[model samples]
Target: MPVLETPPLVHETVVSDRREPFSDIVIIGLYAPKIAREARPGQFVMAVTPSGERVATALGIYEAAGDRISLMLVVVGPRTRELALLERGDRLVLAGPLGNGFQLQALGKNVALIAGGVGLASLLLPAQRLLADGARVHLYYGARTAGALVDAELFEAAGAGVSLATDDGSRGHHGYVTELLAREGRTHETIAACGPSPMLRAVGTLARTLGVRAQVSLEETFACGVGACWGCVVPLERSSAQAPAFPPVAPGETRDYVHARICKEGPVFWSDELRW
Candidate 1:
């Protein structure tokens, strides 16, 4: 994973655009040039709700280009609902480009990118980077219905081969996306995935069964987007390069793994290195 030479800072930006591809799925574009320039694939931002009465909501950096970046989020609660209500020119405060992103070079020349529902937000940058590096990229995407599978054409346009699956059989395969990946066997050099816990675990299991390595970006509710609160901790193997530095374990302690903050050390980890 590449480190951001500059640390995260609050950027007061204005909404450049907003779109609702589905009922509660919102994509908000911000006129934030600094964020666009610093963001890495798989990293996220903590955006203060426009009302300022609620805690900041963590969102993935969906698209980062010249003078702009977009965030894709589902209106799951009061905070997100407030964010969804913002209009063009609405001011938004963000502390961003946080968390360690995916280690793309280690994934090699052929990669399978797996996404579930809104998890697609974290992956577009990786797909774009992989393609620009001359790698073969394939996307296995899934959603509840055909209508929920948004922005897949963006990947196709970026030169990625796309395969889709929906739970209700509205389009592509009629089952879990992991099933589609399994049916195809091991065709890629490695796998990179982001989605709900069950979907990500399935990807990890499938990756093991196929004798391929995989990296998974975890989705969790963050109280403080930085590592301050230690609220979003995951059990990771002590040997993982992404593990945080800690004091020597006492004689009675379990040395097999360490609790790593998803907001700081991760959001992305080697599937095989995760003890959860």
Candidate 2:
């Protein structure tokens, strides 16, 4: 894949906001022309709540069009709740198009994109990009219930083949979406996923069983959207594209793992390369 240029990071203002019927989720759009133009699929941003009472919250970049960048998030705390209450004219600060996003060019033409719950936030751009490239994209999405499957139609409308799964059987499949993927037994050139850790673990195992490559985005509470905080670190079996090149290990020092910053090094990593 070609190298992606990191856009100049800055704070942009909120230009649009809408509440989903799910009651706890809202979509916020920002007027960040620079970030919108440079951001690739799987990139994210850190936005301060409308109240600015809490630290900036990390959210996936859902859509980027013209000067607008939209984010879909479930309001689960004080920070997101404050963000959810914002209207079209609300002012908010944003920092990003951060982290290494999906390696779309290398993924080939047959791809499967998996999402669970709010994990859907990170997949839309990738699916859209893949479709634009004339790739066959299949979106396997799951939620706790039918209501939680927020934007299946959006993907379908964007030219992706959509498959659904809900834990309660309120949607397509009765169990985990990974099982749905497994049952289909379709071969994909690549599998990209973002969800809870358990869901990712399952997808990783499935990819291995199918002998297909997979990239997964790891979600964590990011204190700082940048790597300086080192709070959202995850262990990797080998150095990654964004991993730190630091002091050489001493003769006796263990080098089996390097702690990579999820906020900077990735929110996305190869499923096979991950140690966790």
Candidate 3:
């Protein structure tokens, strides 16, 4: 019941430099080593670009190199667009390994991992853990084109079956991953996903209806990673009768805020835990 001390937002003694698609984006190092040590799949980082206090971005760690990490970010928001202009040596501020992460134990060998666009950033960690644990991972990844594809080969190299889908039919399947998922994913024992909310909700709805064990990482708007304000709360269904209701009418344990942090409670929640 006590407020979880969000491992105080600190400036890591040293920040590393990282390179990506657009921004040579100085890695600015890593934090939450404890959380990173145990960070489940579907967790993320809420970071601020030093340029402007209002410039904030939520980026998913694609690879963790102990003290160094990797992320995929697109130039969308003003903060990111500014972040896009950052060179390799810029300093960035971040808070957390925030959010409740995924659980691999609850998953089985017949696991189907689906991702839309850059949301694949959040799933990489979990996929690696799952494959290392000997689970049969089938990745259904969708993007706009060949250049957008990421980690498909990594998943394949890990011995998991991989499938690709692009809107332009420039890659693997010629349609949305959702369309393929509606058909092929039923064979899997579990489903895990991250991406746009609409896409996630569609999958979550299907998973719930089919009684398939499912987990989804959310992409919600957030302010503080520690849930101080109502900024990041998400709607979710009752996972159990005792489970709290989401979007609480009043403040109490009765509300279960899904993906509150995308960094802290989740970037992942049970499919049933999310409100469609």
Candidate 4:
């Protein structure tokens, strides 16, 4: 994983493009050269609403290339609904490339990238980086339906072998994507996954069964994207390098783990290191 060398700064960006790949799912492109240059795969940005009435929304950086970066969002609530209405040429303020990204070099030569729903947003850049390094990349992607499996072709075009699964049996596999991954057996050296908590937990369990280590990007609501608030906390083994350092435990306390801010220490963590 690359170290965060600079603090996040507010960037005044303009919406260069907007696409509705599927109903309620929007991908908004922005002209943010500095954010595009500094952002790493799996990191995110805090998008300030143009109205400035609601708290900023945290979204994964979907695509970052040259002078543009895009954000993928699902319109689920008031905050996201407001952002989804943005039009091309609109001004959107962003504070990011925030949080740590995946440790690409440590994942070895062959890797399995798993995603569920919009979790695909965080894995594309990792796939591109891995493929560029001459590594074999396979994507196991899942969604609720065939139409919801947006942008599998993007990964295929990027040289990743794509295997898709849908809940309704409208696509590749009838069951969960993890089932497809398990049936294929363990060909990869390591795994990196992002998705719903249930799916990520399944990936962690599967990784253990396959005798491989897995890195998971935990999905949580980050009230403060910079990690000042302890709102997005997960139990992590204290020995894990990502664990935050604090004063020693009190004399009566014997806990072996610490509360790690998902926005700071992670968004990505080793599956084995997680106590939650």
RMSD of each: 2.7, 3.4, 4.4, 2.7
CA lDDT, every model vs. true structure: 0.94, 0.87, 0.68, 0.93
lDDT of 3 by residue, 118-206 (tens): 78877878888898888888888988886677657777876878888998998888887877777753788989888888888788777
For all predicted structures, in order, the TM-scores are 0.95, 0.92, 0.81, 0.95
Runs with alpha carbons beyond 4 Å of true place in candidate 1: 1-8, 250-255
TM-score of candidate 4 on Cα atoms, chains taken together: 0.95
Cand. 1 TM to true fold: 0.95
Scored against the true structure, residue 43 in model 3 reaches a CA lDDT of 63
lDDT of 4 by residue, 149-168 (tens): 99999999999999999999
Q: Residues 1-276, candidate 2: write the lDDT tens digits.
A: 234564358776766656575878677777778888988999999987766678889999998889888888887888888888888887878888888899998789999999998899899999999999999999999999998889789999999998999999997899999998899785788999999999999999999999998999988999988898999988886565656666666789876778889998899998888888
Candidate 1 clashing pairs, residues 3+ apart or interchain: none
How many clashing pairs per prediction, in order?
0, 0, 13, 0
Expressed as tens digits, the lDDT of each residue in 1-276 for candidate 1 is 357765558999999999999989999999999999999999999999888899899899999999999999988899999999999999999998899999999999999999999999999999999999999999999999998999999999999999999999999999999999899999999999999999999999999999999999999999998999999999998888988987778898856789999999999999999998
Better of 1 and 2 by TM-score: 1
lDDT: the better of candidates 3 and 4? 4
Model 4, residue 43: what's the lDDT?
94
Best by lDDT: 1
